[model samples]
Target: MKLAIVAVGHRQPDWISAGCSEYLKRLPPEMAARMIEIKPEPRGSKSREQLLAAERSRIDAALPASVRLIVLDEKGDDLTTLKLAGRLEQWQADGRDAALLIGGADGLDPALKARAAEKIRLSSLTLPHGLARLLLCEQLYRAVSVLKNHPYHREG
Candidate 1:
């Protein structure tokens, strides 16, 4: 199963790219994970709705057909690491590609969130876009590790 992280914004800092890359490399050969960076709409003088509308279009354009969509939002369900690992395993078992959507600075539009198959929150606190990407990559790696019984993740 292919895992795609389709997020708004590009040219992330070198550290962010490197951090995410490290985890991406650790994913199992069968579960190929890739990051698809979409250019965020310029905020400029545009209203929040306008900005989100433009971003929504870009996100929709990047989405792969037949892929299950999971939107990351602050108001979404908060999941434990083990639960996340279970979900990842289920997706792989079902042979479905999963695309995780990360919105830009202004956050995701309500309509877009409504369209996702599932909505999950990484944390209650608002995270910077770059940091959020890094965190997601790390958690994905951790989930893989847990599923494989790798020493990288251990329950206390």
Candidate 2:
């Protein structure tokens, strides 16, 4: 199974890159994952809606073909690590590639959110794009570890 993390942001702090890289490097080869960063729309002279729409268009264009769309949004469903593992198992079993969409600061477009095959939130609280990217990478690695029964994952 392949996973694509398509996030709308560039120029994240060095710590975020290091953290994300660490988790990405830990992922096993079978569960291939790649990150695609989309340039964020400049907020200058643009309405909130316009920014969202611009980002939405770029995200739509960046999406890898034939992958399930899993978008990140504040109001989306909450998922536990185990639940995510179950989803990972299902995706792997079905040989499906999933595109995880992380929107810009203004959040996702309403229509784009509606189109997501799965809408999930990393946290109830707001997070910066860099931290979100790092956290998602770590969680995905944790889910893979659970699937493999690797000692890296410890259940509470």
Candidate 3:
């Protein structure tokens, strides 16, 4: 199944891009894991409401119509690494393309959260949005590894 990571914000630090690319390259070509970064709203002197609206608009426009949406939220379910691996397996078994949404620093808009098919949280503590993206990508790679019976993931 195709896996897409649809996230807000662009022009991340070099390290962030390097880290994400490293894991993404390790995945098999058939899995088709891709990172689609929706350009962040220009942050000049815009009001809070205007900024949020712009962010939402960009996110909405970047989302592909066919993929199932899953948002990463602190308020969402926190699953173990093994459970996440299982979840990915189930999605593939069910023949669904998964799109994971990572919102901006202010967090996801209420409408986006409501529209998600599933909501998952990495941890209770807040993490930098860029770091979160890197973490998500790594976890997805690990999940794929586990699903394929690769030696990358070892059960403890």
Candidate 4:
């Protein structure tokens, strides 16, 4: 099964790349994640709707057809780590590609959210796009570890 993170915005700081890479490198071969960055629409004097529309197009284009789409939005389900692990385990078992969509600064388009098979939130607080990407990578690795009986996650 293939897992992909299709996110908007780029030119992130080096630290973000390093942090994401650390977890990405830890993922076992079958569950390895791919990061596909969609260039953000130039913010110069464009209305929010216009910006979002542009981003939506790019995001849609980046998505692989017939795959499970999961959008990351603040309004999405705030699943616990264990719950996320269970979901990931099921997706992996089904042998289907899964795509996680991270929206741009203005957030996801309404249509995009509607199209998502599942919408999940990484946190309640607002996070920079780069930081969100890093967090998602780490959590995916943790989920995989959990599924594999690795000692990476500890429950209280």
- Candidate 3, residues 101-132: lDDT per residue as tens digits? 88876677788788888999988888887899
Q: After superposition, how far is residue 146 of candidate 2 from its true place, in Å?
A: 0.2
What is candidate 1's local distance difference test score? 0.90
What are the Cα lDDT values of the candidates?
0.90, 0.88, 0.84, 0.89
Better of 2 and 4 by lDDT: 4
Instruction: Flag the better candidate by TM-score, 1 or 3.
Output: 1
**What is the TM-score (0 to 1) of candidate 4?**
0.94
Worst 10 residues of 1 by lDDT: 105-114
Alpha-carbon shift of residue 80 in model 1 (angstroms)? 1.4
lDDT of 4 by residue, 52-143 (tens): 99999998888887889999988889998899999998888777899999988888888888888898999999888899999999999998
Error of 4 at 145 (Å): 0.5
On lDDT, the leading prediction is: 1
lDDT of 4: 0.89
- RMSD to native, candidate 2: 1.3
How does model 3 fare in lDDT?
0.84
The C-alpha TM-scores of every prediction are 0.94, 0.93, 0.90, 0.94
Pull out the clashing pairs in model 2. Answer: none
